[model samples]
Target: MQPSIMLLLLLPLLLFSAPSISTAQDFDFFYFVLQWPGSYCDTKQSCCYPTAGKPAADFGIHGLWPNYADGSYPSNCDSGNAYDASQIGDLMGSMRSKWPSLACPSGDGSTFWRHEWEKHGTCSESVLDQHAYFQAALRLRSQVNLLQILQNAGIRPDGGFYSVRGISSAIRSGIGFEPGVECNVDDAGNRQLYQVYVCVDATGKRLIECPVLPTSKCSSRVEFPPF
Candidate 1:
């Protein structure tokens, strides 16, 4: 065989034998979502108490969302690892106290939690199982006391609009890293403080800086609606 022809044949074999690139879903960090009660339940049409009852005036947990460094996130990555409420029996009390669902016609908060676990928790199985995932979120919420920190900084939730810089600064000072602040406009066309998201390491242990901070739609002045 000619040397050039032999080389061409070998090239095809080599190319076909190379390992295929994987499309398996993986995550880098977590977004611990905290929802402001006032913002969540502002409109009569939007508010609904859970079977467990209404959440306190404090911020209620939204979810511990798994996210990529490129600002994308994964959801329902593994349906086989479906959420099991029985598995989280021990965490019920803490979840009720800290992570209650404020959606309408709430049914013991199971639906909300199930949705979160299935969507976000399934993506974190390698780092934390079902129990650990919920527990980590609860612990993070307890550690990052948003209300108290803002209170100390004189930023009360008294239906008053505050500067975006001031709100972000208070959270950054409290948690050692700047967070992604979200806001929504109320019936009065006023931008109300909504959800606050903080990035957490994959192990669900440490709070880390977000590779790509979430955009805040809030204007220069946002109202911290009263609970």
Candidate 2:
């Protein structure tokens, strides 16, 4: 065949064979992780309140990470899909309130959010856009009153300790699924409640049974420190 004919035959294949950003959909589920601010601040490393002021003494969102069923996960799936604050302008208030960052030298939660978006959120772009990604998390956060759930079950955060089984059981009873409880040490090196990981479906909505739970370093009885 002539060079021109050969080029024409390969043009369609070349265009279609390009890698796509939507392969991010292949992940099995999302780990909707929420961290307790009191436990976070109680650590020796400490934490700083956001510039806007302190967040509520409740569970703050960590990230809605995509993960495989076999304990593997994907991240930074699409460099092209950069984090843009403007895209989620309408949901700014919800984001700041529910997903506040407790990290030191905190300006606003934007830096934390951008990092989450770039690292984890980008992996879920197949099912959610930039706006939907944040909105889904905010909505999910509202649905689960974690502190209320634990308190209602007599698991108050008054520097008291409770069995890890008890904590997970109460949350599971309230939400109808098992929860992954992670603990961190306080200034004095006592293990305290830190983060709670709940599984959400791939759609980023609806609570589901965790295909696999995150490894929690909690002692048999972990402290739930007050803020």
Candidate 3:
């Protein structure tokens, strides 16, 4: 075969064997909510317990109602706090600077939470909102150097909560990214907390679901990579 012809055939094989390139979603993760502690499913697309990756999992994307009681779960979250964009932005910036690999967006976590808030359109909002906001951002957080963000935010990566109904429904629907809980264990018994799960697309654009825990908070630490 001609030298040029031989090169062309080899090039195709080399390209085929090359590993796939990483995208935003590879660094980004998503979490769908099955239900809030007190809030009920408001729409048919919404439900108390839903599959991991379905749209119905977004039912409790926002904070839960404080006054409403759902069977056993009581709303202990502070539902009276106002949204603070500045503080959230500051924290996000800090996280971004610390972890340039994951490339966290610069802005207030409250802004995204605001969208969730608008989705819910309920009066329930509080310090708990701050907790949820920060945790959601951490879902995409990388750069093992930024341990302080977890510490300051009070997020236990090793502890998280999931809904029984939501897990079961996810098992039945079998259409979404089967939801699961993750945690981060710190020194000894101290652990970082991550209450929200934020799922993203390849470019990190689509936010499929953003669930809120009814009463329990989960951890967000990644252990395999040894962070």
TM-score of each: 0.87, 0.89, 0.22
Best by lDDT: 2
lDDT-better candidate, 1 vs 2: 2
Of the pair 1 and 3, which is ahead by lDDT? 1
lDDT of each: 0.89, 0.92, 0.33
Score candidate 2 by TM-score against the native.
0.89
For model 2, the local distance difference test gives 0.92
Which 10 consecutive residues of model 2 have the lowest summed lDDT? 17-26
Model 2 clash pairs are: none
In candidate 2, position 17 carries an lDDT of: 77
Q: Estimate, for each residue in 122-161, the C-alpha lDDT of model 2 and write its tens digit.
A: 9898899989999999988998889999999999989998
Error of 3 at 124 (Å): 11
Better of 2 and 3 by lDDT: 2
The list of candidate 2 runs beyond 4 A from truth reads 1-24
Q: On residues 1-227, what C-alpha lDDT tens digit does candidate 3 reach at each position?
A: 99999999899888876765422121122233322211222222222222112221111232322222121322223344544555466564433332112112323234535544343322223222454544443443431112333234332222343333333233323333333333333344433222223333322224443233233334332221111
Q: How large an RMSD does model 2 have?
A: 4.5
Clashing pairs in 1: none
